[model samples]
Target chain A: MTSRRQLLKSAVLGGGAGVVAATALGSLGPEAAFGAAAPDVEPGAPDPDFAEGRIRSIKDNTLLVLGSNMVFHNIRVVDGTSLWKLGPTTFDQAKPGDGLYARGVRMPDGVLAAESVWLNIVNIKGHVSNITSEKIHLDHKGQEVLCHRVAGKSIAVYSDAPPSADLSLLRVGQHVQILGAWRPDTNEVDIATVFSPH
Target chain B: MARSQPTDPPIDLQAAVRGEVSWFCCGTAWGPCSSTGKGACGTCNSGNLQHAWPNTSDACWAITRPDSCGFALSRRTCGFQHRITALCSGTSVVTSIADCGPQTDLFCGERSCCGATCATDRIIDLTPAAYSRIASLSTGLRPCEISTP
Candidate 1:
């Protein structure tokens, strides 16, 4: 019989590779959803340098990247060591409008524990949000949804359908229908629609 | 009891947010909900067995006892599942939306839950006694989307 540890190790190794392959394949669906007639690059492009998208959510140290159109990308950015800053240090300064990138291992649960976060310069639109140093929170229909971004900053929307953007624009007293994946592993919602006034 | 092949009924699901969480109207607040689609007909027990179906034109469910209802899945799962219990004609039974586990799946697979999918579109997890208490007056409405969450 396979030893417990050996079995676990094997599962991880297989699962790790499977995750990479799954993300690679999963992104393809969005590429297709966005009407990408054809994508030449391999799954997720394996771009070590950078992966940018709106702030879907931050759980632990993972960021779920909603690529162009509806493509989903899980970015992990966490460093266990004390020396490393580990993931995005400026969680409070991160906002749905701000573009973000991180580097981490992709877990089987469709989340990424990043080692670092890169805030890209972009235009995103959102309502006024009370900011703090730890984390920002927004009121969606009396629901205090958490947010990330610098306090007292300009708001802009890069994509109307961006789950992050839609989540930010939600009215405190209005109803917002949500249809997407909440990858608890990464602590993010791969939002598809925020159900705005069509 | 024996009933002819019936139809699935539709259910209404209410959405609410408590403090910071958003979820559907559940439990006693909302009526019965299950894949069988029909409300509980109060026919499940030691002798009066129920027949249900977890999947149909109804809401999703998670199997709590697959063995009792009868299933053959290799691994146990919990997300959305459904089941139906058949009783006397015009009195088919349905299960409510409930968190199912490995043991539940075992029961479901055996045929303890709803034997076949009901015509109702919602789910009800009420027991036979509870169902008999309120099922007489509660006829489910047609299935419709929440339009808004």
Candidate 2:
């Protein structure tokens, strides 16, 4: 299977040109592919189509989730549904206690037919307290976070510079933001991208 | 009440309100979040300066429903720019609305405190590019002020 790190490189390096080409073709014909259409939900109401929470159980191809706010969600995953964990993964990789964010069409029965599901994803801002060969220690508003670096997957973008797969430019005491996959039930995360000032 | 037009004049940044802000990842990454691709506006990127408001459209409001937590929010659609200032560091950044989130009701009255400042209620979520500009990524949430840029 193609790993998510490879996907990230392709999307960042190649997706831009592809998107531009698709947009050009879309302008020439109404039927040209332009990606998914916007949802038709009401103007000021909560979206019934998206759900985020922790997995309570997995039954058949469905996930019973408990939201961070105490709400319950029933999410269905079909063959077309895309699942992501540390990388592009499958539903079988999911387990109870996994935090998730899913987008799909909410069925009339109140179940969400998920089109995409991301597990343990987290984006946070923090101060780089220390950096070692294996991990970067961060102070996030007084909370400690350990960010593990994934080779070929973790990238860094400094200031307005383009993204590079190099982490050598990072330093201690700098404030940075990280986008990564959170380890289930931990204060640690697998780094995907790190944004920092030059 | 009728919603404000996208082309309406920019709201004053100084008069903006206070809330707790957090960050989230989307677009071109490992795992399931990679499929999120561009967010609801088809324009959101983890590399771009963008944000998700509780109420971007009626559909988004239906999901976030800040009102359920006793916080009423305006219907600001995608591409609407809001300038957010980090209260602790006095740092600020301007980000456009890219998605809907923070499920304010889930953490109703939830607060994040730093030093002498504390912010209650989850109000806004930002992209990595935007949040890192004004704060550190290790900090899960920070107190912030929101206003139109």
Candidate 3:
């Protein structure tokens, strides 16, 4: 298991300016806005195919997964979400080989150092409250929150929650319902049927 | 035979959580919705609402109902690699992720403010001038590395 303290220490000591965060768990502030100051163009656009992989190993907060393309990926799942069934509070209960999808800085070291990694989750929902580079920060039930997306981004299943409801019609103030798996460490929330009022 | 609340269903909360049931999704692995913040985006400041965040290393916990800290789910979006570095001294302006050859330490030019302009591993920090170049972006060249007290 990776201690948050070790992860923090290594972020500064292990190398120069190289931060390998597992998901969005860093006290570090925002990365100077790429487009905030300068005009931006879509360079390697955020591919919906943010790669899917299986957990190959766990090093501290780092998770090395075997990407579908045969590439080994090191990731960090943010420990938070908008769904309840996904999980909460810890990463110990998670299993490797489960699918994952995420985006962040990729290191030449073949480690896909993540800002956030989504796990296989679903049928959970919530409202967005704020935005920052550090986290897709949320306010679930008044507690500081984080989101760990699961099993790629498209929330795609249902057995409980509202079956006839689609997760698309949701707005910030609008109420929502969700379902899926969750892990507490990477605070990433995965949704399968984000429901909302039309 | 026991009766249930009119507003609440007669299902076991625990069973519903553990049961393999329906699941909506955000699409992309780490679904980025109105999805992010430094530390303030939940149900901590609203009224008439039940906030929902993902479950962490353990079980899913709910937020206070009627807190106001979340935004609309659809109106949030960004596609840049926001990063953190320790190489700032008096010079380098650092930006998103830079790959250091398989575990080798590295740096991106002094605040390569834009991700497109940066050459991965192009700028480094080990000398005085290097620090000055970086510090120039936010603050004038740092005289020397300050140690945290």
Best by TM-score: 2
Per-residue accuracy of model 2 over A14-102 as CA lDDT, tens digit each: 55653343333322111111123324333222345567778999999889998754679998765545676756678899999888776
Candidate 1 on A28-147: residue-level lDDT in tens? Answer: 211121121111212111232223355677565445666433446666532220011112134454545444433333345655433234343211112224534433333432334443
What is the alpha-carbon lDDT for the whole of candidate 1? 0.27
Judge the docking of candidate 3 as incorrect, acceptable, medium or high: incorrect
Estimate, for each residue in A1-198, the C-alpha lDDT of model 3 and write its tens digit. 654333433453355332454224432222221111211212212222133455767767667776544666666543321111243224554466555544443344544433333355322334556433322334544543454333434242221222342333333453333434444245555443332223
The lDDT of model 3 is 0.29
Residues B1-149, model 2: lDDT tens digits: 43332333323332687888888766554333433566778776664677888877767777676776556667778878788888877767777888887667655665655566776777899875566445544444678888876
Q: What's the C-alpha lDDT at position B96 in model 1?
A: 28
lDDT tens digits by residue: candidate 1, B48-75: 1122223321121242222233322222
lDDT (10s digit) by residue, model 3, range B6-65: 243322221211110111222123222113221122211100011112211111112211
**Which one wins on DockQ?**
2
What is each model's TM-score for chain A?
Answer: 0.31, 0.76, 0.40
- Candidates 2 and 3, the one with greater lDDT: 2
Error of 3 at B69 (Å): 29
Off by over 4 Å in 3: A1-51, A76-88, A122-179, A182-193, B1-149
Task: Give candidate 2's error at residue A46 in angstroms.
Answer: 2.8
Score every model by TM-score: 0.21, 0.52, 0.29
lDDT of 3 at A68: 43
The lDDT for every candidate, in the order shown, is: 0.27, 0.67, 0.29
lDDT of 1 at A158: 22
